[model samples]
Target: MLNIAIAQLNYTVGDFTSNVAAIIGGMRTAFARAADIVVFSELAVCGYYPGDLLEDAAFLEQFEPALEKLLEASRQMPKLATVVGTVRRNTGAGKPLHNSLLVIQDGIIIAEYHKQLLPTYGIFDEYRHFEPGQQTACTLRIAGHHIGFLICEDGWNQPGRDYKINPFDALRRAGPELVISINASPSDIAKRTLRHSTLGKAAADTGLPILFVNQVGGQDQLVFDGASFALMPDRRIVFEAEQFSEDFQLIAFDEGNFTAAGGAALPIPSQGLSTEEFARRQIILGVQDYARRCGFSKAVVGSSGGIDSALTLALAVQALGAENVAAVTMPSGWSSEGSVSDSQTLCANLGIPLYVHPIASLVQQYGAGFKDAFAAPLQGLPLENLQARIRGTVLMEYSNSFGALLLTTGNKSEISVGYCTLYGDTNGGLGLIGDLYKTEVYALSRHINLQAGRELIPEAVISKAPSAELAPGQKDTDSLPPYEVLDEILKWHLEGRRMPQTEADAAYGFVQQLQAGDEGRQLVKRILGMVARNEYKRRQAPPLIRVRARAFGSGRQMPIAAKY
Candidate 1:
């Protein structure tokens, strides 16, 4: 029997020291567990998707020393083989490097395989950095068992895919007893289910038991859910790891069957989290890691007593404890009384301190100065924008004074329709819910309350009509359609084919029904135009935690200067 250790770890990009140390630590733990081999996720060395860091000579220079250190560490545990994902210099006529996997034992490299497929679409641009590996299968023998190897995207090409090559076919031809695939797959809505369906089918078709390992952590706009698992040809997921966190486990493989480390039956995997719970955990991890990496221990948000800000504050508190999160309510002349009172109640319920910073004076000064300088009254859209800008500036001042990261509170709907001021409400280091639609924002907020079993977010905040509160008695509906209507339209326009089949079909049908009527067609045209015109604002906005298949930052790329 061969004992295989699955190491699902969290890695920080460009932090070679911490990453290598983590690898060595996992190796020692696996050795202690008497495992024959330990498997780590893809790009474990310098972290996954290092982007332009791959081009830096100095950054590339660190890999050699790090590898040497791993080699030296391997010498100490010669009996245990280690499988690691990293980068290597490609001595061929292509890109300067290749995404590589290495198997090391006793201070020597035993086997190596470069990743075959490099995805270029939807937040992945592997082709821009490294050359693809040759279309071939790699396998190795250890402890009397034959094991085939695959990088992340290699295993994605099933029988009927459009790719030129199928690595699984080559692996099948190699006729290994088992297969091990390493991945750095990022998490999205329903992504876990998709992984299971796709990989399970691939496993059954190949008639090979497979071990899939993945990494977990937040990397800027991306968050990886490490729901690693072992799949059998019988279409069963026998072993699975935790999601949204680091996990390690050992499984014994004998005669193409997997069991617990000590030859016991594996426990069945749970059904997994709901969509809302998944988003909450994902955003929490995103905020935690983003703040920890960016050197901010505390976070602050401008509390408008609306669902958006309330939810942002609640999520920030969950990520960094309530003591670490602060709320500043900048009430203007047009602000409702419930704005401050509701914010106080929300923060009080959350156990976080609330600071009331009235922005009415700041708005007056800005409006007066603008009128005097420009020789015209600042009374229309500019006046409303001045209020948002004043609030933004006050929040920034608080952030600067307290060394807290300001969290932006615009949802995807408002952002899509250019309902936000560029540098005003968008002035923040990171966004927690910018990828979620206005309707989704409410759904998640209600989920939070239900999960807490109390009114953690005041019901007044959730039930109140959505508004910017910049102008007197202004509601969001005054400018745009209701969230129920606008969200579906934005989903069809922004996500389209990228959304899951159920959502895509629903959104498409809703849009088609709207297009059938002249007024609805005009509204759709206007909404589309608003989304197209606001590319500049989104381009300047802070990076948000991505929960959907197609988020704004890297997933959806559109040229601002071009006409549609």
Candidate 2:
């Protein structure tokens, strides 16, 4: 019988000691089970996106000891063949490092494989660091079965675009009986089915069982969902590992049939859940891990009646629970009755305590103090910004007083174009929804209620127009295009990586409106200008849970001063 284990874990970038320790623990468990092999996610030791830190000499110095420690630990598990992802260095005249999966056995480095497909477009820049691998894949004999291996990005292939040659083809050339893949492939609603089909097809065509392993949890804007699995030679799923979690799985293959044997078989945390529902789980875990990793127990947020704050509060309540969450309702004069009602309703629904503190009195007091400057009518963005700043001040004050981390809740759509007040609405310990768009936020809310078969967020809240409510008769659409229209353009520009002209003419007829006249240009200018300018704000915002493969934080690095 052939035994395999998957280590789906939440690994922080540059946290070498912790990552190494986790690998050791996993190896021990895999050995105790008498498994011949244990697999981990790509770049598991250094987190997925270490960015340019792999180039830093000082960090490399700090990384060396972890490798020795890991190797020493692997020696203790001589019976287990371990294939774990990590940065492997080459101290030669060139070739700085490789994003490699190290194969260790019998107290020696059995083999190593560098990723051949160095994704250069969108959020990846693997091409910038390590050199692409050139060696043909080989089979490893373990437990009397020949096992093949492939790294993340090795299996993904899109038609039309030139894709790197398949490494698994070369690996399968040796006629292996089983294939093991390690991945840090990030989460995407569209990509999930493709992942399963791809691995299953590989297993069926090659007549081998494929065990797929992936990373989990949120680091910056990228969330790695760990729906690790095993595909039988007949292309049927025999095992589905947990998703959006740190987990382990065990599978056995004998007599040309595979069965899930042990290692905590749980329903994938996110399957068929709407993007937001999945994202909510991802963000809650993101916040929970971020707070725990940074050494904090509780979190606090300002709960306005707005969708952003409501969703943020829901996530906090779910993540840290009602006992550890505190919501402060700081309302200004422009705040509507519905807004206050929604906030209170959501607090009760989530079972969290709410503190109602009217900011009108504070605003009035500030007005009295600045009577000279406030003698004239308060107008434009400055006045609108002041109210937001006031709320930020109160939330931070509470954070300091209670030692609770503050979670900022700005959606990707808002953060993309400077719809947020920099130090005001942007002030917090982390931006929970900073990677998600406005439309995505609503979808996620609906998914959550649907999943629970009850309304956690009110039906009116979902149906109502979104607003900051800092000004009378305020609505997001009053300043920006409708979310449907805006999200379409954003998906084209951001995800499709295309300019306006590149989009289908009918799908993007708004270009004509944008170029029609001064008013058009001005509105487009406002939207585009905010998007371009807000890079700085996103750069400073606290780390958020990344539900997508590409989010605004570390996964995507744009020049704050660049003109798009």
Candidate 3:
């Protein structure tokens, strides 16, 4: 049996040097296990979703030298055959760009393959940078078997496009003993079913064992959940890798036979927690990753007794724990009575320290100072934002004083359609729920409460009308459409179709035609246009946990200054 290892690794975008080190570290683990072949995710050396930097020779320059390092490292392990990824140069006298996977054995480059398919649609524009390779799949002779390899976009799709060659056809003709596919595929809720079915099809069609390896961890707005796996000749998952984290698994095969001797299935992250539990767990993972990567640990948040603060505090408590999480509650003239009490409830439940300071007098003091400068009545959006800004300022004061990461709790639905203050409520080192739509936030809250079989998010918190409460009587529905309608439109329009430039050409117009005449021509175009227009805010907003299929993450690249 030929033993194989799939390195499901976490990598940061633009951290070229560290990425190389990670690749070597993972390789060393595989060698210690005494595996015959060790494979890594596509583009693991340079991180996936490099965006337009691929067009810059300087970026590729930073990427190529790592290949030599891997080759050099291979010398240390004589028995291990390594397959790793890096950007490669195009052969002809054209702007050189090729997504590549290289196989090295005994300090020798045995075979190198370029990606055959270059995805140019939604969230991908590989055609803009990399030139597709027209070669058949390359095979490496390992452990008395001819094993084939393909890059991220190769051998995983069934397309009718002229640009990308069908590598599977060529590889099938070559009749390799095993076909290995490497990917930097993105993650989402729907991923589990889709990956299972699609990989099953690949295994069934090839009748040859197929190994699929993926990347893990967050990069900018994207989070890659590494659910790497191997499909046996029988079309069953013979080997499985962990999800949402980095791991290494070994699969042994003999000629056309397969065996999985290592790696265990990881339990899914506990998604349901009391309001205290849910917010804490998701936020902790979220805060821990973003803050730790960006270089911070302790964090502080505005701890108004409101649901948002309650939620953000829950997350911070989980992430930084009681000692590390600091909550500052600043109540202005309009701040409700039970707000502080609710905030205290959450902080007490989570065992975190709460700081209560009045902002009402401060606002009055500032208003008095600005009496001559500002004649407008203390109301409307301006007045509402003043309170938020004051609270934000206080949170910042605590954050700066203690060198703590600041967390924002605006949910996805609010961030979409612009319901938050730019430098006010939106200010923070990271936005934990920025990608989770409001409806999802409530659902997640409810799920946590139900699973815990007790009141975690406090019944009053969940049962109360959802409001920002910046004003005396402000509600979310007053400024926006029902969340149900907005979220549905978002999922379909944002991730389903391509964005068009103007109102007439916008995909939204097609949605109007849904029952007009044709069933097929959809309004998906309009939705994507909205997403494109909103890219500026997303770019400025701190990175968020990427749990959705097309979260505005590294995988979802949009041109900042593009026409249509």
| Per-prediction tally of clashes | 0, 3, 10
Give TM-scores for every candidate, taking all chains together and pairing residue i with residue i.
0.99, 0.85, 0.84
Off by over 4 Å in 3: 52-65, 159-164, 262-286, 449-456, 496-539, 553-564
lDDT of 3 at 430: 77
Candidate topping TM-score: 1
lDDT (Cα, tens digit) per residue for candidate 1, span 1-564: 999999999999999999999999999999999999999999999998899999999999999999999999999997788999999999999999999999999999999999989998899999899899988899999988999999998988885565798899999999999999999999999788888888888999999998999999999999999999998998789989999999999999998899999999988898998878988999999999999999999999999999999999999999999999999998989999999999999999999999998988878887789789999888978889988888899999999999999999999999898899988999999999998998899899999999999999999999999889988899999989988989999999988977889999999999999999999999999999999999999999999999999999999899998787
What order do candidates take by TM-score, descending? 1, 2, 3
- Predict model 3's lDDT versus the native: 0.71
Q: Model 2 over residues 1-564: C-alpha lDDT tens digits?
A: 878777888898888888988988999999988888888888877788888887898877866687778778888887788898888775554467877878888667788877777787666788888877765784688889887777877766423144657776676678877778888877765456667777767666667777788888766556677888877768677677777778887777766666665533433323455555667777877787778777878888898877888888877878888899988988889988977788889888888888988888887777666766758655567778989989998999999999999888888888787788878888988888877778888878787788768888888788889888878898998878998767655654455532223333533566565557897567666667667777887787777766655567656778977777
Q: What lDDT score goes with residue 363 in model 1?
A: 80
Query: What is the lDDT of every predicted structure here?
Result: 0.93, 0.77, 0.71
For model 3 the TM-score comes to: 0.84
**Residue ranges of candidate 1 with Cα displaced over 4 Å:** none
Question: Which structure among the candidates has the greatest lDDT?
Answer: 1
